[model samples]
Target: MSSLRAFVFRMRGGLWTLLFCIILALARVTRLSFLLGLPFVILGQIWRFWAAGSIGRYRGERVGAEHLVTWGPYALMRNPLYFGNGLIGLGWALMSGPWAICIFVAAFALLYLFVIIPHEESFLHETFGTEYQDYRSRTGSFFPKTLPERGRLTGPFSFSVLRKSERHTLWTTLGGTFLIGLKGFFL
Candidate 1:
């Protein structure tokens, strides 16, 4: 289980994207599927951007943070970035236009919840100690438990952070969508 978790933690992002892209490339995607799924992809990107922008200096390593960030999306959900990734993958699955793809998306989410988050949370707990515990006690892991705690917003939204955190995601999403759209167009 630990090895499985480690594998997921290391490879979930790239592997899942590749899986979705490969499936979409081979599957028959209709215009309706592309249309239906686009909103989810957009929303997911927005969520990721928001989370990345808000993290400011804390966007260090994935398994660790320089400081505990409980602002912006962090105030709402413990793992907003991962949640956003789920949305993006689900969007692509929907665009792929097969019920089986949806199952894959659900399975991916389950893996995230069970394998990835536990490992990440363990690292975070070790790193941030009581601060993370306090944040965890109050915040939902994947859902908003309360309104964002009133506080000054973290530093001005940083494009550098967004680019640093999401460049690959942004490009992969666009490229995959383009491929899927092209497939829909030609077939």
Candidate 2:
């Protein structure tokens, strides 16, 4: 059997699990709330774009930050992108109003807490060492500990980052919601 880390990584760092569950649960059941969740799908895409822009040009797959992003939404929460993704899942559950979807969201959150976050932290610690430790000490993992302050270092903000990140996430976010709507409309 594959090891736990292997399995989690295969889940694309737990994103696959949440996306699958969101699609499965919402598509399986039809409801008005699912329609309500449509907006959050768009918001999720926006969050993904902004977070990627903040991080740099590459996707979130790189854990070892060549540089720390202490600006943008990152200034508010260390993991705003992940938190926003969770909100997307939460909105999906709200849209579907399905008990099963709710369970899936809870499961996703737990898996992230237990499986994904720790692995990512270990990687970050190894990568950034003391800098990462200090960031973690001050930053909240999933919530904002304090108000955001403007960044000291300014780099050229790249829309390409948005395009790049959104390219991967948009399909899952919008397409998954579309699939749910399709099921709701057709079946």
Candidate 3:
């Protein structure tokens, strides 16, 4: 990977957090838009929560999975975290305005497509070799493949894992929504 790409892979989480803050701070929520986007946000959170519970806590500032999680949300997509992020971002954008939607799509494509996903894919390939390749082949990055995935699933979900790693996301989701709603209705 290029130095720039490596740097981005390292900073991807912070970047997304920054983006989420920007989105929340600038969001122009309306009842209609908020209602429309609520489902997406809920679904995204559910997805993220499930993924966090399925996979173990993120170990360090590196792209290494302690175990290849191939059950639960992993069965549906290769990058459930990113997929959920996309959904959340899209929902936020939708709540914000049309311009935010455009910005979110562009940023998502640039960050996830060009930098983060590729780097993570490389690392996963290096780490798991054929196992990851097979998993990659079977699963879509954001969704499941057309064909049914038939196999004995591994790895059970754990709420403890979710609590350890994902409370911030939950809190942010709740706080952001509250602020947006408050701003829309009262502020």
**Considering every candidate listed, which one attains the maximal TM-score?**
3
Models ranked on TM-score: 3, 1, 2
Error in Å for residue 163 of model 3: 0.6
What is the Å distance of residue 98 in model 1 from its true position?
3.2
Whole-model lDDT values for every prediction: 0.78, 0.68, 0.80
What TM-score does model 2 achieve against the real structure? 0.81
Models 1 onward score TM values of: 0.86, 0.81, 0.89
Cα lDDT over the full model 2: 0.68
Number of the top lDDT candidate: 3
lDDT of 3: 0.80
Lowest-sum lDDT 10-residue window in model 2: 147-156
Better of 1 and 2 by TM-score: 1
